[model samples]
Target: MADTNKQSSEKKEYHKKATGNALTTVKNHSKENDLKLYGSCFCPFVQRVWISLEVKQIPYQYIEVDPYKKPDLLLQINPRGLVPALRHGDWGCYESTVLMEYLEDLSEGQSLLPPQPKTRAHSRLWSDHINRHIIPSFYRFLQEQDQQKQVTLADELKTEIGKIVDVADPTGPFFLGAGISFVDIQMAPWVVRLNRVLKPYRGWPEPEPDSRWAKWVKAIEENEHVRATTSTDELYLDSYERYAENRPNTSQVANSVNSGRGLP
Candidate 1:
């Protein structure tokens, strides 16, 4: 308890500095106390913070940021100009994991991170694994066009999925046995998206061991916090087109120009 309080006090100091910059550049959220979240619907990092906020039962005013044309609020708040920047009254900060760790300390309503240090470390490890290993496969699966490459990407993704499943408590609906934790929230968005993305290819004729993965994927999708973060199907599909279609292309085009190379 003492350690938790100390962590909260320290984070508040960092947040105060960032919030000052955001206000100097743009009008902060009008509500005095509502938490402000700067993010895009398409960013999984931002999605992770959103899920963490949801699981903590923290109320935040969601503000969309166009990553292509980063607004002054985002630039000022993050300085590095990243999404998933968080503001709570006068305290604010950026980086999804930092925001999540801050919330885990601040909110006592539900403890997202485990109290035990070893367990907390494990959660952080898996969170890193999910972000590093699993998320890349997710983007690869999204970008891969050839059916064969998609299938291979799916297989590679299943291996990472197995790693997450290994850490998670299948007996209950979360990472830390019966209770939901920050670990679950951090990884839930991409885990759920895996099911949604691969669903279309499920019924198609395939010889690989995809059906088993499909079952596990469904379980991740059906988890309460995972489902809670969802959008309507029509909206989700439109969002898919917007994100998967344009963002990657824009990044590629920018890289091409900066490198003095032709577009593909």
Candidate 2:
């Protein structure tokens, strides 16, 4: 019990500096809340759960954990020491998407999944597609140094992002419809990060003008939930820069300008 108390004190100290430049801090929610999230501000995966909590109006204690310096408590909850682990009372959950669904199940507010069964299934499918195909392909594209390979990667990423437009609802602002769904929460972090960080410096392509992707981007940017959950643009870019430098073979493109380059 004494050891546990000591660790809790250490985590609190770490959180003071680890909140980074996020627009939302622990202060946004009350300390008495039983729901606690262990994560860093810089992680987009973490942002997904954070956005869900805000959108659902679920009060959770946000505990910032440095991903690089895995704390004992974080490790105890998730053996991998990954960020975005959630603890409600004595129960714990890991993985951002899993925790998002768990939180949705536990809380009362806007349904993260769509009401229609088919649409909800589709939402789950899109989330899976993003995790399996889009993220990996885009990261690989950014890390590629060879000119021909970079071109190939750029095309791959363009095709993948275009898929989101193809799958998005034609009648409205979000991926599902008028309301933000689980799919939207899953995709928003990467979309926002890419637009702010990669689009300007690395020449990542924007969805075509007047297209569904364009509309979605505008709507997401205007979303109150997204606005509240997201960090400042300066901090977002700065964190991504640092991340690129840290990830192996990913630094070259992040460091270079895309002026007159083949990247699109």
> TM-score: which candidate is best?
2
Candidate number achieving the greatest lDDT relative to the actual structure: 2
| Model 1 whole-model lDDT (C-alpha atoms) | 0.61
Each prediction's total of clashing residue pairs, residues at least 3 apart in sequence or on different chains, is: 1, 0
Residues 117-235, model 2: lDDT tens digits: 88878988889888877776666665555768778878887788788778788976899789888988888888887887677547877767987888888888788777766676666
Worst 10 residues of 2 by lDDT: 12-21
lDDT of 1 at 200: 45
Would you list the clashing residue pairs of candidate 2?
none
lDDT of each: 0.61, 0.73
Residue pairs with colliding backbones in model 1 are 112-182
Every candidate's CA RMSD? 14.0, 9.6
lDDT of 1 by residue, 106-224 (tens): 75467887779898888999988876777666666565556776688777877886787766765654677766677667776765555444454332222235444444445556665
Query: 68 in model 2: Cα distance from truth in Å?
Result: 1.2
TM-scores of the candidates are: 0.70, 0.82
